[model samples]
Target chain A: MSYSILVVDDSPVIRKMMKRSLSLSKLELGTVYEACNGQEALVVLRREWIDVVLADIHMPVMGGTELIEAMSKDPELSKIPVVVVSAERNAQAIAHLKTLGICAHLTKPFTPEQVLHAVDDVLEQVAQRSVA
Target chain B: MSQVLLAGPLGEVTKSVLSEAAFLFCDELSEGAAPLEARLVEATITFEGATPGRITLRLPWHVACEAAANLLGAEPGDDDVEANAHAAVGELLNMISGSALERWFGSGSQWSLGLPSVSEREGRLPSSAPRGELVALAIDDARIELEASLGSVT
Candidate 1:
C-alpha cells in the first residue's frame, strides 16, 4: 500500500532528503508534499490527504511543536500521525512532544534502518486505527 | 574551556553525525591537516539553556556537495547540489551542536537551538571570535571544522 507523506522543515535539503530516504528505505510512498514551516504545513494539511508528517522542531515562522498542537486542535488533521525527525536532545522537551501526541521521534544522524523502523511502526498503527 | 575537554567530544560527535546522516566515513584529524580555503560553507548555531554558547561548523565545498548528493540520492553534478549543500550544512551544524550539548550537559538538561546561519570563510575564523578548541575531521578526502565556545559572544 502507498501512503501520502508531508515533510515539514525550514531546510529545503532536509525536505528533499526525507523523500529520498523514504524511497531508500523501500517505503511505498504516494504523493509527497513539502512545507517550509508549521504555517506552511497547516496550509498543506488543509488541502491534502497527508497520511503522515515528518517534521523538525525548530523553524523560522513556526516550529514543529506548534504545528503538532495546531493539528491536534483540528479533528481531521489530528488523525494523521506525526513523526518528529529532529536534532533535539532535551529529555523534557521530547517528553512534552510525546504528550502532545507525536507518534515517533527520530533523532538526527539516524540510520536508514532506524528511519524504516520508525515509519513502519507508525504506518502499522495508522492502519490499525483505520480498521477500528 | 580546555581544548582537550572540548575537542574530544566534538570530534567523536562529528564523526558519528556525518556517518549516520550522510553515510560518510570520517576520521578526526589530530595534526597535519591543511587549513580551510576557498569554496567552503560555514554554519553557526546558538544555544540557550543552563549554559548558553555557540557552535560553528565549517566544511569544504566538496564535502558539502557530497553530503547533499548522498542525502538526495543524486549525482554530484546535479543542478541542485550547490543549493542543497548550503541547506545541508545548516542542518548538519544543527546536529553537531545538539550532539555536543547533549554530551556536555547531559540529555535531561533543557536547551534550545537557534536557527543555523551560513557564513563565508576564505581560510580561517576571525581573531575576535573566542577561540574554543577546534575539532577537525577528514571526510572523503575533504576537511570539516567544528568550534565550540561557552557563553554568548555577541
Candidate 2:
C-alpha cells in the first residue's frame, strides 16, 4: 500500500530538500504534494487523500501552529499525522506544539536519517492501526 | 566586558544552526559537492526586548549557486535557480537566528526580524562594532563567517 505525503514550508529549498530526501530514501510512498504554507496546505488537504503532513512552524501564511489547531478541529483532517519541522529552538514553542497534538517535532538542520526515522515511526504506527 | 566575549557562545550557536540547516537543505553526503560553501549574504534581522542583536547572512555567487541548487533540488540551471537559492538562503539564516535567540532569551521575549537584504558581494559590517570580532567556520573547506556588533554586554 502507498501513502501520500504533504510537505508544507515557506522555503522552496526546504520543500525540495524534503522531497529529495524522501525520494532518495526509496520509501514505499505514493505521489508527494507540496505547499508554500499552512493555508495552501489546507486547500490541498481538502482535495487529496494525504496520509501524512510534514510542516514548518514559522511560515508566512497560517503557520504550523495555526495549521495544527485547524486540523485538530476537523474530524476528517485531524486523523492525518502532522509533523512539525522548525529551526526555532524555543523550548516553550516546542511544548506548545506538543500540546497541540503534533505527531513529532523535528528540529531544523536535521539529518536525513532523523527525517527518515520520524517518517518511519509515523508510517509504522499508521500501518499497525490498519492491521489491528 | 567586551563584545568579542559574546562571540564564543553566539558563534558556536550560529555555526550549529547553520550546519544543521546545511545538512537539511543540501544533500551533501550524496551530492558530489563535498565542501558546501556558505558566504554571509548581506542581510540583517533585529531582535528586540530583553536581549537584542542583529543576525546577518552574507553570500557570494558560487556559494549562492550551490546553496540554491541544494535547496531547490535542482542544479543551478539559470538565473532563476540562483534567485530562488538567494531567497532560500535568507530564510534559512532568519530561521537559524530566530531559533538561536530564543535559546539565549527564553520564549516570552518578543522579537522581530527585518527584511533580509541580498548582495552579490560582502557589504559593510554593522557600524556599532563588537570589538572587531568575526567568526568563520569551515564546512568541507568552504569558509562561513558570522560577525556581530553586539552593543551592550549580555
Candidate 3:
C-alpha cells in the first residue's frame, strides 16, 4: 500500500534529495508533496491528504518547531505524524522536538538507507496504532 | 557590549559541518589562493538568544557546480551553465547553514534565514572584517574552502 507524505524544508536541494530518497523507498514517489517552509506546508496539508510530514528544523518564514506547534494545536492536523530530519543534533533541540511529539528524528548527512529506514519505521508504527 | 569570541564549539561545529558537506558534494577539495578567492552563497538569520550571528557558505565555482549537479542528478557540462548550477549551490548552502545554526542555537531559538546570494567571482573583503579560521575539504574531484569570519554584530 502507498501513503502520501509532505516534505517541508527551505532548501530546494534538500527537498530534491528527499524526493529522490523517497522514490528509492518501497513507498510510491508520486504521492509525495513538497513545501519550502512550515507555512507552505500548512497550506499543502489543508489541500492534500498527507499521512506523514518530514520536516527540517530551521527554515525561513515558518520553521519545523512552529509547524509542529501549529499542527499539535489543531484537532484535524494533530493526527498526522511528523518526522524531523535535520543536521541539528543538540540536546536542547532534540528535547524541544520531543516535547512537540515529533515521531522521529534523523540527523543530516544520513545515508539514503537511513532515510528509508526511518520512513519504514514511522509507517510501521502508524499501522500498528490503527490496528490497535 | 562584550566581545564575542568565535571560539569554542561553534567554531568547531562550523568546520566539521562545512567539511562534511563539502566532502559529500564536491568531487575534489583543496587549498587555494590566500585572502581566499571565494564564491559565497550567504543566508542571514536573526536569533533571539544571547549568541546570534549570520552563517555563510563560501564555495569555489567548481565545488558549487559539482554540488548543483549532484542535487540535480545531472553531470555539469561547462561554465556557461553556472547560473543554473549556483541555484543548486545556493540551496545547498541554505540547508547546511540552517541546520548548523539550529545546532549552535537551540532549535526553539526561532531564527529566520534570508535568501542566499551566489557570488561567482571573488569580491573585495571589507577592511574591518575580522580574521577567522579557514578549512578546506576535497570531494570527488573538486576543492571547497570554508572560512568563519566575525561580523560587526554578534
Best by lDDT: 1
lDDT of 3 by residue, A102-132 (tens): 9899887555678788888888898999999
**Global lDDT scores for all candidate models:** 0.83, 0.68, 0.65
lDDT of 3 at A94: 76
TM-score of chain A of each: 0.94, 0.96, 0.95
- C-alpha displacement of B43 in model 1, angstroms? 0.5
TM-score between candidate 3 and the true structure: 0.75
Taking the tens digit of each residue's C-alpha lDDT, what string does model 1 give over B27-73?
Answer: 75646666545567888888898778888888877888898888777
TM-score-wise, the better of 2 and 3 is: 2
lDDT of 1 at B23: 79
Give stretches of model 2 more than 4 Å off.
B1-5, B17-40, B47-49, B70-81, B106-154
TM-score of each: 0.91, 0.77, 0.75
Model 3 bad stretches (over 4 Å): A28-30, B1-48, B78-84, B87-131, B136-143, B150-154
Fnat of candidates, each listed: 0.90, 0.46, 0.25
Candidates 1 and 2: which is better by DockQ?
1
lDDT tens readout by residue for model 3, B37-130: 4454433333333454454555556666666665656567844345556666665555565565665554666544555666555643221353
CAPRI accuracy category, model 3: acceptable
